[model samples]
Target: MGAEQIRRWESGALAHAVTDPFGQGPLPWLRGSEHYVDATGQVVPWYAEPDRDRGARGPRTADDVHRQIKGFAASGAVAPGQAIDFHITVDPPQQFSVDIYRIGHYAGAGAFKIITSPRLAGIVQPAPLAADRTVSCHHWWLSWRLQVPSHWAVGAHVAVLTTADGYRSHIPFTVRDDRPADLLLVLPDITWQAYNLYPEDGRTGASFYHAWDDNGRLLGERDAAVTVSFDRPYAGAGLPLHVGHAYDFIRWAERYGYDIAYADARDLHAGRVDATRYRGLVFPGHDEYWSVPMRRTVESARDQGTSLVFLSANSLYWQVELGPSPSGVPDRLLSCRKRRGPGKASLWREIDRAEQQLLGIQYAGQVPEPHPLVVRNAEHWLWEATGAGEGDELTGLVAGEADRYFPRTALPEHRRRILLAHSPYRDGSGALRHQETSLYRAPSGALVFASGTFAWSPALDRPGHVDSRIQRATANLLDRICKRD
Candidate 1:
């Protein structure tokens, strides 16, 4: 598309502007892969292709174990008409193809296949270059450059890279738009990059949280990276560890026809997004990292009556700063000392900015195993239906890391505060701990909710993990946020 055409599409001035077609009934354009049909029946799938092989599991070879086909997006997100570069490396030097899919509720098809690249030769890129406590691939060769189509819908997207030998991996990125929507879904891209230990060959992989000693002994925060780069692929299969949490929420929300826009966390730090423009800002995954500007913006938005929803635990815990890439692309480097260091990087709580002061509840402890989510304020509007009552326990609803209200912490002033779920779980040390899901109405009439468990979003849509009551409760919260209730 030409520059003017792309601009028109982004400005929503095109004759057939892309839109969320879910829950709009089965229109003629929804038939087949074409989610949007323009005049003269020009159909655009917009990455809505189902039945494409998205699996990366196969028999392993020396090349697969040592260096399988893997890649990373040059940027965490790209707007329509912008070109995104994929840096990929394939072992044994083989040809590969990339299939791009936009993730959403496509009438329950899960994703739409938007683009497929012609087969291209792939080469093993250079090894990761290690700097002071950091590993980066800024020198890797660009394998593919995709110019995002102007009419592509805004949502979470993934690129599946498959080699001639059937080895596959994924590269995830977001297609963003500048238009306003009822709610903004910000993916935890910074946290994803923080936990990525690329080149996990048992020798030189290091995230901001963990690393391996020269003797291959696993080391903790002390030996971890003080800074992490966005230029390297995620360890293992190139997928972020907690990405499914965000995807599950997206599938459920889109299925219900919520008006949602997507962006990466870095977008908030870069001031590319205006949180105040939306009714609610949704963080639907393991969003554990935060920059000063990001926190200030979200908090400022809340003070202005924009609701904030955190669907998982341990959010805004660590403070981070963004830096330019070695090549000077802004906000490509994430620096968090996680302790007293040369820069202002530490836990927000340690700096007297306890997350509870904003979230109403703060990180408490980790759940060693799944535990029932014991309902507390069952009479609250958040639990209006789905047959939940006080003391009712949703089996295995509380797991992974969790949060709870801290009595001594400086809490956010609110018109009303409620503890929705109080669940007991044993920690790794066999100590008794409790997790509490919280909801508080800010003085500005904005609602802030903390799910207090990592499993909340998974229960929204993941098969074998879905819970109707939890789903209903989440819908209630979101509906209230959008004033649809």
Candidate 2:
């Protein structure tokens, strides 16, 4: 319901305690500071309630930045015995202790830590250059490598780097799981990094849609981040967006003892997954940016009978390219050329790959106000045992963002087509429209389900704000799908 409640539930998903949940300890650069920036103009101090000066930036001592730590890799995943890279900023070069803890339910103690890397030492250096200078891409030099112990269980790992004086910052990554399971959950790492407004300056600190110039004008197609890198810390959460949405889905799945593996979007782009090994592949939340290869792989898997679930809205919309990162890793540099032309790479619609054709629904625009989802086809198998009926309202299910069916678009072949929720929304042009949550069966016997809203996953946790109707609906589907697979 509330942010703190969602966080407590997530924190309990862990088994035991290691350290207090990672926080911004002693870091001086904060997003809500008073500062302003102008294109071709100087940086000045300015703070306004409306944040009228979008790119306004404040001053930071070089020493304050030196104490910050940033982990850089295309994905947080690293195999046991594998080493991950991270950077640190501290003035005059001092030795700091590096600790690695696996964040998971340890025997039900909730978010406990096991000392994977205990008391390791490294020299902290000056913070990396903010490469773009205008954007928040911090190209911190590689400070150290953390090798995972071969015996550690596969889960999310948080790297806590602390100076001798105890100043600290948390860097998070995942331990790769190559094992087969009935379901695989993908944390939208690429999308998260794309939206992260680290060093939250108004002008240069944005993803494709996050830019605002000093004049309070949104960045144009060309001015937006043409290329974004992963070599930086998230402005908050160590991950962008939430511990409650996708992360909560993870806790729910795990708490129930469902067999699941974790990976990021890059794994899909790189063809690292044997999708056939699992019954379903899940895109957890706010999964927007996609590469050509990522789409092809997911499409192929779905056509071959593997179930695909998108637990969030605004998915597979933008077509981006992952260029070479500075570290020579592919898919590190996210490029979105949101424009029209023969050579232009932008939205999926512009490239003629309309996501609706595969998803059976397209972006209808976003629902601004919190509203209820009107169930359109309650008899559908997904509604089994939920006691829902046609015309019944599912409160708080339509929120944050939403998508509606595109009539003119070609949809995949299906035996049973059902619209679960019919809710209203407005497009970027602010025209009144609606979003629909739909389900259909493919020719190959695959079942495709899209939650059609960003709020769906949080609803799964039944956070007091929403009822158990959503929770019951999700469990019914997950049980049937995993059992069949």
Candidate 3:
């Protein structure tokens, strides 16, 4: 059957299938069997049909050995009635099709198929242009152009690319709308590009974090790219390294029917979004890269009574500058020299604008292993219904990177501040380190929350990592933020 035909058949079958209250489908990991009511009061199923073949081989590193097919969206996001381009490359050039899916909590199917493209001829695009520590594919041929349907809802979307032989990959983007919502979820597209080691063929791939030497030895930060372009596909399966963190939050938040709008981080940096229009702004992933305008706008929003939510650790750490692509598309190139260049290319803290001053807590250190999240200030409104008490420990809730309050740094002068979690974990060297989840109320009565650990969002929806306490606590925070004075 044709791709579109198959999509129709599966969708029809799902609509008639007995509803699974738990939302667990045949592929429990990828498909959900439950249903939930949306903000519009319509019942939606959370059922994402699993791909027969995802083409993902194992751990995807900077060096992606299985490069059957890959692609990238010309823009990280597009609004309804706008058109976006997909630049794709296929090894052993063959025909392929693109299937679009909107990622959400569709009654437990993690995603809902929106449309599918007919078979289109595919070919290998030109190689990347490397210069001055930057690898760019600004010259790649456009594989497809999608004029977004005006009826599509604003949310996180992905285009799945499948070759004739079934080699598949994905390209994630956001469908944004101008209409205001109670909460705005900003995807960290800038950080996604910062860590994208495209063409991860070992010889020429370069991201802001790392690159490979001529002899194929992985080089660290000192030798990494100072500038990274968004014109190339992401390494491995074409998904951003920490994208799942944001997806987890989206699924969990949507399941609860939160009135959330979506935007790309680039939209914030380019002055395309009015942050003050929303009651809250959420950064749902490892949003490490920031431009001057992005920081200033968010800070201004907070001062204007717009709350802020950082769901992951290590946020707003590296200060960057977004420039135009070689083709002059605005905000397509990200540059952060990270102490190697002059001006705003260093850490925000080095520029005397410590992240803690805005986030309530700044990056502390990496957690080599999962540790318990010890509850503090459990009586606070943020922990209202979680049944958590002081000194209660949530196992495996603190891992990956973490943040903590620094006494010496200039901090935000909030009317009230509280540390929600104060857990201690050993570092790689076995030295003791503490991670603190924090919340503070600004003079404008806007609340700023920092999860202080990368695992917080994943705990909300990721299988085997879901923690009911975290989910309830997050709901409490958002509910309070969305409430008007």
Candidate 4:
């Protein structure tokens, strides 16, 4: 058998072996390869290296120094399923440790497979809570071997464990996988609205949560304590209140068959995307999070004829930084504003102003009103395309009047065809005026359709079918743009 294959079999079938060709085995090890032929002409074991391993441990050294793991290639690019080596070094003078822990989600939890030594994959992880590493030269080498899952969402956390003085220390290492800027769905780490308390402290800006039980179907509440929670404006109803928005958009978009990709704004700012790859971008659900670079990237792309679908509201408010964090969620410093309320100061006022002037939208304000009514904009092209009459339920996630949030004067002189003045016949705000959702558009074919009336998604929790006419219209609009020739 090859060295890679032998290592796999030995690691699995021959685990706990005290000593073998794989070296003094007994310490935990992780094997990335299935098999590799050895020089002895007999199938001998290969020591676990510090690259990426699933289930295994490291090879022990006598002098405590060796180059256990090293990089094979330096280029920041890879084709799917490409094979590469973890060029490792083991200095017998210094002790080294190799750890293999899943980053995104553990097995059977989510689709993506994350091995941190190289990098992370997927937006979340299963059992990616922690892993152990050894510190050497005052510099530790942490490696993870991961298999990229189909449709990976792109965000990661590492399980870090430091071994010294015969003791181990556990720490969480979070890393972002974004490398490009061009995408349609720039999804921020948004699980906070589903939690009882924001997972990280208010300082950590990651707003997302994920949990699963024995069966692994993403459990909502396992411990009876709060599994998830948000900062302010997200305390009540959780995501159930916004389930309608998710369901309706998915249903409509799927029906029309659009090429949609969900990405976080952090990725855009990092220049990880080749904007020429896709035609348009869509912001779905509560995309209230924003970073300065994210805003700049999107605006630049839009100006370059990349159609934008501002499906959600309260966007581009909080400017955040994307970097490493020793803690679970990383460092999040709020740099935006409240638009309303007492301490309200437009956080990234420039970005907000840019959106208003460019897209004809603004964060008018938020309200506590339920998704009671659906106002109509009969004259607008988006509405006219919907083929819906007046009195259609505008399923708003942050339901409020559209005109109140998106003012007409905000429209740039270039594009008036996209947005018609809110007919005075209605509340004169266009879509029911509200804070949570807003609407705006630019003349460059970029569009903003905010549903201020929140919860536009027909509620699955509701007894009868709710108003989904607007939902259908949204799907049609996206289909028209995304399907452009």
lDDT (10s digit) by residue, model 4, range 1-485 = 32222232222112211111112121111223223343333332333232223322332211101111221111122223432222122222223232333222122121122443332211111111211110111022222343434443332222222222111211111132333333355444332232222111111111222222233222222221221111121211111223233333433443444555444444565576644355677665445555556677777766766766655445554444443323333222222222323553435544345455534464554433434344455555456555555554433333332223344445444444333222221232344443322344455565555443334433311213344555555655665566543
Query: Which 10-residue window of candidate 1 scores lowest in summed lDDT?
Result: 15-24
Candidate ordering by lDDT (highest first): 3, 1, 2, 4
lDDT of 2: 0.63
Between candidates 1 and 4, name the one with more favorable lDDT.
1
Instruction: Estimate candidate 3's alpha-carbon lDDT, on a 0 to 1 scale.
Output: 0.81
Off by over 4 Å in 4: 1-145, 149-183, 190-248, 326-346, 350-354, 372-375, 379-381, 384-387, 391-410, 417-443, 457-466, 483-485
Candidate 4, backbone clash total: 89
lDDT per residue, candidate 3, 11-57, as tens digits? Answer: 21122122111112222323533444444555543322222265322
**Residue-wise C-alpha lDDT for candidate 2, range 1-485, written one tens digit per residue:** 22222232122112111111211222211222334564436555321122225543332221122334334443457777887777655443555665666544344322445664445445544433444432423455666766667987776656655555434556667777788988887777778766655533333345554444565343534555666777666543244544346654665566677778777788888877678778888876778888899889888988898888888778898988887766576666777767623477678986688888778787765565656788887887788788889888777677767777888778878877777888765544678777798777888888889888877776654234445777778777778779743
**Stretches of candidate 1 above 4 Å error?**
1-65, 340-345
Error of 2 at 66 (Å): 7.7
For all predicted structures, in order, the TM-scores are 0.86, 0.78, 0.87, 0.48
Candidate 2: which stretches are off by over 4 Å?
1-69, 73-76, 91-110, 120-127, 130-141, 162-168, 201-204, 211-222, 340-342, 425-431, 462-466
Q: Which candidate is the best by TM-score?
A: 3
Residues 141-240 of candidate 1 have per-residue lDDT tens digits of 9899999989889899988787887666778999998788999999999998888766565456777767656654456678888888998887755667
